[model samples]
Target: MTSNPPLPVRPTRTAQPGFPWQHFSMRFSSTPRGARLARRLAGERLDAWGIPYGSDAHHTLTLIVAELSANAVSHGRVPGRDFRLCLSAEGTTLRVEVTDTRGEKVPTLVEPSDALDGDGGRGLLLVAALTDRWGWYPCADGPGKTVWAVLEVGTT
Candidate 1:
């Protein structure tokens, strides 16, 4: 009996208008230093994309990247696996996505607590506060998840 050939794999693509879209993506080590580098690189890219370094949009995006990257490193890290950072800018909205190698540790927003003595567990809180919207999803074609945040320019 002859076995059928394996089905061809299709690459995933994001829907976009005919207009040009700007995007940047990179993988970083799953470490604190890597998180720091993600924030720095994103900041530089934002500045280059006409968002001034000290503007509200720039600052907010930087904070979002910092928190999300930190969470990926702390909660989603796997040995010998690096996390991925992706940025896409279309029109006035910028989307930041960080994918890590731990799919089971999905992130959820937590209610604010009266007690302020905790040593950790506030990364998502910060992300929610800074971004216009944020969410997480398991990778469709891999063994990990991506945490994403979106910020709109000129929005408070």
Candidate 2:
């Protein structure tokens, strides 16, 4: 079984040392629309941090968020629940996390078979391919999960 550690609750105050790290977060309904919003918001947040839209780093991070967020909405959605998108850029490393109210469905990465088409069954695979490292952990409440990925950004 994959080991999914539990995540600590995010404090109500954002005062931890190096805490903010240029971050932004939003909770959206766990729907297709929410997934789209997560991707757009990620780009906007990256832009605010000076990673312009369409830039390599921005594009890569957006794509990563897109896949992970979509997976959460599609595979991890729970009725009446929402998913969250959080972005943090510290120095050159940009961290992105998507959390959903589903703890049982941990993400796994595997090579896509030739029989698989590019349009399907490629989301997590793409995430694993693009992210420096990625994994899932139980949400602080113990009833949900969060999947996170990290990407390094620098002048291209």
Winner by TM-score: 1
Which regions in candidate 1 have their CA more than 4 angstroms from the true location? 1-20, 114-117
Candidate 2 lDDT: 0.80
- List, residue by residue over 1-156, the lDDT tens digit for candidate 2: 899899886434211222236878899889999899889888887776677666667788999988888898888999999998998878677888999999888877656883275556777778777878888899987588889998766523
Task: Give per-model CA RMSD.
Answer: 11.9, 13.1
Global lDDT scores for all candidate models: 0.84, 0.80
As a whole number from 0 to 100, the lDDT of residue 154 in candidate 1 is: 56
Candidate 2 residue runs with Cα over 4 Å from true position: 1-20, 114-119
Give the worst 10-residue stretch by lDDT in candidate 1: 11-20
List TM-score per model, in order. 0.83, 0.80
